[model samples]
Target chain A: MNDKKWIVLGLILFVGLFSFPFWFNVGKAAPAPEVVLTEQAKAAKECVMPTDFMKTEHMQLLDVWRLKVVRDGVSQFVNADGKEFDMSLSNTCLDCHSNKAEFCDRCHNYASVNPYCWDCHIDNPKGDK
Target chain B: MNKFYMSSLLAIFALALIAWVGAPALPWLFGIVLPYLAVAVFVVGFVRRVMGWSRSAVPFAIPTTGGQQRSLPWIKQAKFDNPSSKTGVFVRMALEILTFRSLFRNTRMKMNEGNRLSYHLEIFLWLGALAFHYAFLVTLLRHMRFFLEPVPGAIQMLEAVDGFFRLEILYDSVQFGLPGVYMSGLVLLAAAAYLFLRRLFIANMRYISLPSDYFPLLLIMGIAFTGILMRYFTKVDIAAIKQLAMGLVTFQPSIPAAISPVFYIHLFFVSVLLAYFPFSKLMHLGGIFLSPTRNMLANTREVRHVNPWNYPVKVHTYEAYENEFREKMVEAGLPVDKMPESAPEEMTEEEKE
Candidate 1:
């Protein structure tokens, strides 16, 4: 048991010592040609977008609507033209972003991002061409 | 000066070195093999800890109640705080776990003009904690897309709902850039940082804070930092990562080419976190069930508590006492069942019988 402990400790120490540079070097070295914008800058840019999209002032209204709908066990959905419509969670979002690979993969690929989400989550909605 | 700070800094330095040196030589082992091992350890350790908790004997129904228990008709009762029945306990536990009801009622004391104590609502901590937990949960749920061949619609829906503000803009056009910016990750990081800082800065909190408390916070922060790095800075192959994750889930493991070394470093920290979770203060996730404050009801005062240690004893009968004292009672002019002269003979006869 003692020997095993020492071995595991040694291995952890070895791994830890070797893995630091990879973490620290991120975003510090030469900027990759594919790099579009830093995460901070991206967030900042989004913060400056139009108020309608940002919804900062209208958050209370949305919150009230959400609380009422959820409390009453009512499902609220609308079509693209704001017409009354019935839709599930997936269809509601996927209706707009149709091509998952083209849209999601393109940016993530350029960004060199590894999203484990696709492992379990369905990227493409069924019955959507 | 503390062991936690010393050890964490040392570990961080070591990992930085390893990441630099081991990049080219053992990318596959670091990137692919280590993550698989971590996930396995996480699942097994989590289950074992939960099982161990379940197996431990409670020996008593000790639900912690903060309100009045149900008693007489005249007695005013606090139903939610002090629940007397099983249903009430269930409701209380549900509220506690789902909404952190107790934390929402937290109070902080401050000294006023004359050093008089004043109580104020401390809702920020509660809100921060709530935000952190929900964000962590959502982020975990969103990651489900990587492990399964066909991701669940529910998870996709969650991602959409989370990124609704971003996705709704391009109704007809296919627009995507680092989808959603993973706002939950940022929120979780901020909350965790705030909690850590609060513990460090507040004199009372700092006095009571232990190395165990700080270590978990550091580990979690490390995981978050690495994750952010992988997403925005040193990009790894998502498709390859998905394949690797799927392979691990399915039990046929394979390391895809072109996976980044930084990804492995992130995975390593996450794995370390998982392995440490069961042994650390993080067990509070399970410890909430055993908490005296949350589990014990305030009914001990009203109920009769018989100590399980009462025993029976042999005793002399009153008739025997009267017979022995009859002669003495006659001599002293007290009433006797038999005459003194007859009593002695009668006693002898009784003895013989």
Candidate 2:
């Protein structure tokens, strides 16, 4: 073959690049992150939304809550089951799922997501509020 | 639309539908079996295609020189454009690949009103192409976060840069809590769409365009659309998606329940694209490196290039011709190197050996 060395070099590059994920993760089967729910969360029996909805749509719901609170000044959220709760993350959501590292950061770190919620809202609010 | 584009569009839809419809019942097939198969086909087929190209010998140095070639030392030479040396050729190839130097220089010839000719520089094609390719590359690299355990800092940094202009406010109408929109994905989709429109609206381009040309474009658009939809509109359990991605990479494939069918559709389009890569124009990825016209050194004048396929042929030398025609030359009173066996005494200089 013409330019045998160059062809071989290119093939090596192609194979190496495409097969990267395999060798990079070889023997390193990092399991999916498990978010730890607090005792308060467990006792409550359910979140504002269902577990499935919360798992997938929590970010959007939280965003809406923020918008509603800040923009429209509406603080109360009425869930589908006609139960009213405060539309605040630190007050309502964290009131139950308290440990941000255990509950929020685990999945966020696993998914490599850096949600800016921590930039403003404290992970663990103190006793007063 | 042309039948070719329609067929390609229909094909993508069919594949997406198959994954969406078949995923619940055959998660193993969509999530595991097909992905592996697609990768296998892509790798093996790509190698085979490259090998086939290698086997076909390029008998000449046919680099398309775009500037003054190497000649007299006093004459200015365009070293990179009309490269006569290996290093010059390397620089030329690098510039051609990285910055698309040739496409930047692309001009379309136009017949003037007065029977004259003119050339207009076509820069948008180059811009669109550059945008399309770079965005695609960034998007592909960003996806490494999913496959790699302990996702690399580089990818995370890239994601940050790509999503620097956070449009969280715009996403409120759609389901909330979505990550800021990454520019790479949007740019890729927009660029691909622009290229598609260029093919459709431009008269010359439309005339030259074939089904093969439109298939990849439509397929890519479908992939991008599904990807964007999954990220923002029909949000999937990303953590679950990441888990599946990690599992696939680590050879421990398992599908989490209740994951959106949109994910499956996206995966299916990608799988089809991968499987179709080598067989389509996408092989330009490899073909560009081996292209004789682009990759060769423009040194045909300075250096001799022997044709490898040349074979020995019987030939009559000048000596043999002179010897045969010696007697006739002497009789015709012409100069002769040698005397014939029976010749005139005055004409005879030497006996025939």
Candidate 3:
């Protein structure tokens, strides 16, 4: 009985502490700050455009490389850089985007966005290339 | 029939009623107190359950093998299904955890011509399950930025990659309108609902389905529903909610008033899920490690196993019995050894004196 009472009391205290946030800002109603896109952000956004004609060329090059590897029946090591590597289904895309940290992180931090992927995925930004 | 299911149903119904009746007073308890309690319960309960499972004795290597056992070189083997080595087992476990490989191979039986049984490939369940799990994973990954102070670069990269297809025109014009719709959340809910409904509606599934299964499905659905409501309908202050979440993560509690009551409702449901996860079927997350089928190897046939429970017992030897039986055997005209010419015959005590 005593143990139960203590537990209940502890829960009450914890809840009271958590509730401070709701009550603390009762008088304040400041709106969130608007996000301003920088030149780099605009460039990054443009680079990712769905209708960008350059993407077709990029995709075609990838397809040609894939076809060549498949035809040769040889292990495709590295990304056009002639470095030795393992071939697996998991690392298919990593062949090209070897420097992921350099290419990807700049825009994301600017956007103030959070992504849940790092929970389990390992970032192998620097591959054989 | 099962206590777990019955209790779950009762608790859920009771909570639903409480939420309905105490709607006016929910902001105090549901918004604040319940979440704290749930988190406490989740952490403690998960640890306790895992410890208990780890302590339990498993005296046998009872791995469920679906292929040929390790034997002579001449014999054929099932390499992937019944792995013979540690590396193979690790590979199998990896595939199973990451891709639900076993579920993918699931088949359904049906009657064919002449009433013959035939197996049909059932891929819908696998697809739905995969969608649900991956979506859940993605959603979880997206939420990590709220918890950590200096968000990792890798996570940022993933976020950018995920939202790469966003309309540039909209991005330039509005500047912000919920960035991009997190498709994973919607996909997760839809897939989970499909799985739940299939179990409820399908005959075979319904027969095997117990209340425990239904409860988790319902609870998850409820959580998803509340979350969707918060996102699309309520439109709570994201910044304030993040501040509150960050504060919780930091151990310094500050509840922002701008956070809506609907957000509280969503938090309450999430809290309930956390508390229930440890005690409920969701513990399969931990139980997978202890599963004999997944962890053990099938090597029992090659090795001798002594029953640990065997007790010592006195045994009667034949030689001691023979001395007592020798006189009786000679009198009864049974075959006996000549005094010095032949060896004496051995006998058991029950046969002799």
DockQ top scorer = 2
Q: Model 2 over residues B239-259: C-alpha lDDT tens digits?
A: 899999999999999887778
Could you report the DockQ of all the candidates, in the order they appear?
0.02, 0.68, 0.03
Model 1 quality (TM-score): 0.61
lDDT of each: 0.60, 0.86, 0.59
Mind giving the per-residue lDDT tens digits that candidate 1 earns over A1-129?
012343344345634543333333344322112323334334544322233432222222233334445565556645244555333324533344445565556534433334544665587666554
Number of the top lDDT candidate: 2
For each candidate, give the interface RMSD after superposing the true interface residues on Cα. 15.8, 1.6, 13.2
Candidate 2 reaches a DockQ of 0.68
Can you give the TM-score per candidate against the true fold? 0.61, 0.91, 0.61
TM-score of each candidate's B chain against the true B chain: 0.77, 0.88, 0.77
Cα distance off (Å), candidate 2, residue B129? 0.6
Candidate 3 residue pairs in clash (backbone atoms < 3 Å):
A21-B254, A21-B255, A22-B255, A115-B141, A116-B141, A116-B142, A117-B141
Model 1, range B1-353, lDDT digits (tens) per residue? Answer: 55655676577557656764674577766656766676566556655666555444544446566767887989988776897665766677778877898999899989999899999999988998898889888887777666543455676678767665542222123222333467777777888888888878888887898777776776677667777776544545555676666555555656766566676766666766766776787866656644656655556666653433344668777667767887677668888665555566686797688
Superposed Cα deviation of residue B179, candidate 1 (Å): 3.9
The first chain of model 2 has a TM-score of: 0.94
Where is model 3 more than 4 Å wrong at Cα? Answer: A1-111, A114-129, B1-28, B164-177, B305-353
Candidate 3: lDDT of A74?
A: 53
TM-score of chain B of 3: 0.77
Q: Could you give the interface RMSD of candidate 2 in angstroms?
A: 1.6
